[model samples]
Target: MIALTLRQRNIIEYLLSRDSYVTNDVIASNFEVSNRTVRKDLEVISAYLKEQGISLVRKPGKGVWIEDKQEVLFDDLSCSYSKNERIVIYVTSLLLNDVNTFMTLASNCGVSKQTVINDLNTIEKFLDGYHLSLIKNQGVGTSLEGDETDIRRLFIDLLFTNDHSKIVYELCINNDGIQRNLDVSFELITVIENEFRFRYVDRDRISIVLSFLLNRLGLMKTKNSTIQSSDMERINSILSTKISDSNDQEYISSFLLGERVEGSLTLDSKVEDEANEISEHLISSLKKIHYFDSEDMKDIIRSLTVHVRAAIYRCRNNIHIRNELDEQVRFAIGVMYEFTKKELNVYETKYNLNFDQSEISYIALYLASIFETGVQEDLKVVIMIVCTFGLATSSILKSRMYQIFGDCFIVGPYSIEEAEKYLESHEVDLIISTNYMSVKSTNVIYINPLLKQNDIEMIRNTLFQESFMKMCSLFFNKNKVVEHDYHCLGEYISKNDVSISKGKISWEDAIRKAAAPLVAKGDIENKYVNTMIQAVNEFGTYMVITPKVAYVHAGKDDGVNKNCVSLLLLENEIPFGSFNTKPVIAIVVLGICDKEESQLLNIANILDIPENIELLKNSKNIESILSLHD
Candidate 1:
């Protein structure tokens, strides 16, 4: 007698289960084994069948099939085996002779007896292996020790490895008589089955799968087929009844209308019709909502529609729902409704929102914070004009400083004692003192506050310019002014107006007489043009007023012109005008009169102020002088 290996027996069983033929590739792919292994098994099965006088035929790509069967030698092995050997042999024998039971045996061999019993309990796989009777005799325990080969073969013939294929075949037979039945495509059926399979194990996966298949088919056919609105209403009425019968009103409400129903109703034909009508309406509504431009909203609608539809289908199919499932559905619906409301509100306010003052203030504060954090880096300085008393002179001096510095410096007035007390702790760069008050320990640079414009300009230019010769000259010049109260001749022209001499006078004498009062006040001194040149060289430019330039302007002009003298001197000129004719006067006031300083030379040139003559010489009275100044 020839013995068949377990794999060879599997190949034979595999071929026996097929009505037509079995392919080697199919066997290999199914078993996840090499093709050579499958072929070797097939060769062994073919040789074993041949020895038994059974013919096995191969038809190349078509596959191998059993051609003929003959009576085999070991058809009755009972005579050669005892009962105990038979039981052990029967189990092992069943394992070697069949594919399904072989799988069970291989699975249970290494596990505990409890596991084997569990395997035995699965009726389908347990009875699949051999031609034997399963007898359970209470105290005797379960046994599969009786002979029944033909019955087993018949049973095996009815089964297939792929369960889905078996289901499709059964469905085709059951629904054959129904007219206009749904045409099920393989891919569509598989997709619907897989989509809800794991998610809904307790419910009928096959029924839900079929419903989706029918729905897909209907939707495809209805794509271009238009039904009138009235017909749609009738169709919806029919569907709503079906929908109602399938699910409770409250459960159905969360899905179709995004609201809850208050009461329950009987699941009669009328309720079925109402349910169907509602479902139809829901499907239409979902279709319309699915095409919404926003993807998020579309997903929301689709999810709710699917939930409601599934509930109705399950209800119609007599499926039960757990409390947990119902609660989850309710929670999902509530969340979606809230989200939809928020989205709608957002859309409503998009075109109407307005920014207010608080918003602007917040923005300004944010920008200020950024600046304070090193976004902008520049120092802003302020100068305080302090007199013993805060009176007109203090105000006048502050105004003068502001006129020169303008936005470049912050200026204010305070009393001397107030300034001294404040300066004790406050920061200041420079202090101009009009009185004899002392600052014994402060670091501030001090100067005479009663000084002329030339002295102020000299101090300013010296502080700014770094040239050695200019610094030495500035020091010597400052000392001379401090020691002798020496002021530039340009100050004489600035103070005195153009006057007609009462007696005959030479040009030099007339100049001296015009300049006499300022000289008496210790304001006018020699080398005035040199002082103005130093101011111009240090500060880039300076103003000038000659006896001639001033006199001529004083005589010819009134109002603002009387107080304003001629301004002269180019950027490169050095001592360009005489003391008696020093056209250039005070340095272009630093930081102050920026705009006026920018146009001062241009305006002076336009007014015909000259460099070599007293332009204000013809002024007759102080009124004319004040008028010219104004």
Candidate 2:
């Protein structure tokens, strides 16, 4: 026997696998080695093959191939498995099969016998993670040396971690004995689903898994191993009735915990509590990317809570499943996905666990659906959305409603009849109905059943007016009213309540100077100016309403005596921060007496228009500026 190097054996096996001649480039790519290295390896391989009565045939301008006068030298290493796939095969074999010798495993995987030896080294490292070790005997075979339970757990863990897309091709591709076993396994799954009154999300994947397990039922290894699960006893009994082997039963029962049958998971108090806390955290984290607070959002909160509970159960049990939407979520909302991943580290650490990206990806997906709606607003408008369409369509409309509206509290995607009955008992601020309301209220808006783009446009405009009127109604009450030096945005300025600066000033100074007019007139105390400065320090240029203008204010108790507005018009727009891309041409300081909540909305409305903002920037005097708004 020639002492062949591992690469020589691999090159020989590679050539043996190919039916026709292969170029050095092809071999190089397969082995991830250079063509020069491959040529050298082939020289070594050729010597070894000659000793074995095999010839390494090289045809110029064609490629190199093995010429064997005899029959098949190797069982075709063409169907080579990737490292990950090989790892899965090793894990599966280690659990049930005893024929785990280097040569035997290599022959099965279509690689050099030495490749299996190298793979075993890697496999041993993986086993260490599960607190299991490989007991290998030289020139013989390897066996899993650990608790039966740990062995089973290692199997389950590896199965979920890898998709193993090709793991069951032989078993599933119409072989007689294996196909019969597959039929039994599939029937077992149906029985399990029926027994639990729930179905597997991916039934085909489960069938593949069960089929793999059934085919590997090696002539009764022993009844030594038991899978640790809350339903282990029940699973054993269930599998026992169908499967005869007590030890092999765990193979079927272990994956029983992987049953994620949507909304079917029952949460105990402790899990429920953790779920609640984590759900709130998830929402708070996502709110950074978008404004939230609605009935649909509440449903999201509940759905999120339930999902986290299931995910926690799955993680604690070391059961990870493939979420199909995982990649889609990570790509669609990459920012939210990354942010959620970072935010979830707190929960992971607090709980003393690591979460699979599949689990985190699911959370990201739920949040992405909400974030995708792109409805940015702070004021919450209560709306009763009545849809005559079916439940599925209404459910869709509700999602669409969230996508389009800001901070709205949706009452119901009720039928017209449901809305009428509800309206009698409960007072909603606005009624948005697909079917016209027979009750006929001033707040109601009718629309098409489809809820088209034009309907959204009309609905948004109506909602804006409704929100403004509702805000304006706040200051109409007498007790809510405060005696003020200036009654409105124009009046404060009409009576010596503004600043005009040439060139530029510090934003802090701009805010202070802007509020000076109101401060001097006693509409607000000097303390209000300091609060505005501190707020800007804390919240940045959030007050900068429309890129060109800023609205600065503190709480009314921050020494606001009167509801008033003041503006600092800077000739050269000054950037608020070192990195502030939007410069402030004007800073509108609002000093509100609690009743002037509508002022923010009003100023936003005026400055929101580019023409009005441009006019305000050019206004030289109080009268000219006041006239700009008018």
Candidate 3:
């Protein structure tokens, strides 16, 4: 089936949502896109609808509307959407298949050959980042040229891209190499859960099941195939006649045990000696940073030992488990996440690997449990679940919700009438329903009853906003809120502007140049610059906050004239010692004469956004940079 782009799907939904036909110009303005872009999106949408035996009528003045409204068709398009995701999945499928010609791939993906070629170029770049390559021979067609483990890693990554569970289940049931008669993937998942005696998270289960199916498809293999006597016995009890091959049993058992043998997979070792060794290092590193307490030493060690063991295995094999909570974790945890990431770098470098956001998030998840109560305690937003399909489904969803959200919500499953009555008497922060209900509430969010990852993300984002608002209300005066320290980037730049460094410079020289702006602005004396340089020379470039951005600041005691901030965009990337791979593209200097007037935290928060950092780097003038604040 042809997948629609997010914009195309959104356009269709917009048209469907409205009774009257809206003009193209209106939509273009609404979406902040050119009229040409809107027209093109509509054309794609209209063509897609036409293929489904529906007509999208367009009147020049009145705009566009569907002739026969088909919510089911639109819903299907929405479900199977996302252009980048489709391209990634299509390229992955082509890489695994026998035929790899652009024509054949395009035909399979239901796109033009040119589009397939373009996607291949994008795929090539993506593979390069993973230290893999896409090679196209004169007659042998195209292939993914990479280490066997990396190839398998790519497969798992692609499989878990969009609507992972739904897509994986279909792949397992329909793939020619896998058994079509039985739901082998689902059954294997159940067997693993039973043998392991621990429930895998929804996404993790999908990844595991898909990995098995991919193995059955002869595209991948499990690393370790060593099955213990006890594990083998348990597997036999669970599978019995379900799995016939002894090798298959061993392979599945090894995967469950998390032993690294070959294919990209997480290895779990229960060896107490190794566990103690890893736990000792983990605890020691965390203690040096004072990230956690020694009170729960045994439990922390045990938990982290297992986790780190699996993580080391994953790193060695290049298997990265996607963390759905990565963005939320980073946004909420902020400096804590950064600190955790930095501390974990010791292990990462030892393993000769770079930890993805997902892996860092796992670490944050560990620490957040320790120090999160202060922020997380009062953030529970009451959630009412409305699902007509019995209590079993609701109970399952409730359990999953709690698993993902922790104590962030007070969720209750309610019938439609029960929900209405409850809402009438009590306050509900949000309503999560399978089907659209005519509820007079602005906080109603429609989600799949199955609780898909995308649905979870949508719900998470909503709750995040709600929690942020609640936090703000609690801290700030509701009516007379404190204003932002600075109006915009332009204002900051104009007030405390610095010259961009010319030519390549040392990290020390760069800081000196960066501080010149503060000195010129009279924000700080020349002594402050010397203090910052000396501090960096002594302690190193810990001021390098995010990628391409660094904040250079010394304590008010060091040397300070007033509380102000200045920006310095470097013409060339400057390496700051052996700190990190990230080059210092923009240097934000802080002058803190007094701690009370310092907006260092707010400045860091603003620059934390990657796009804004890009703006700061690329801006020819302050006016251009300020445009981003809009």
* Residue-wise C-alpha lDDT for candidate 2, range 1-630, written one tens digit per residue: 444544555677667677887876567646644455777778877776676677788886467877763543554322346687777677666665554677766765667878887887788887887888888888778777876557655554554544563463432344354455667777877777776666777676566567656665554465542336455566677777667776777655656554455444444446346767787787775555344664667666666676786677667656666665554344333334555676677878887656677888888777755654434342357898899889988888888888878478887899878887898888776778877677643367776666764467557655654553333232122112332222335733454666688865788788778887787788899888887766554333335445467767775468988777777788887776322123668887777673313255445444555677677767777676776542
- Return whichever of 2 and 3 wins on lDDT: 2
How many backbone overlaps does candidate 3 show?
5
Candidate lDDT (C-alpha), each: 0.35, 0.63, 0.59
lDDT, candidate 3, equals 0.59
* Model 3: per-residue Cα lDDT over 119-183, one tens digit each: 76677777886678777788778777765556544556655433343444454445454444235
lDDT for position 230 in model 3: 62
CA displacement after TM-score superposition, residue 146 of candidate 2 (Å): 3.0
For lDDT, the strongest prediction is 2
* Predicted structure with the largest TM-score when compared to the true one: 3
Flag regions of model 1 displaced more than 4 Å: 1-23, 26-37, 55-630
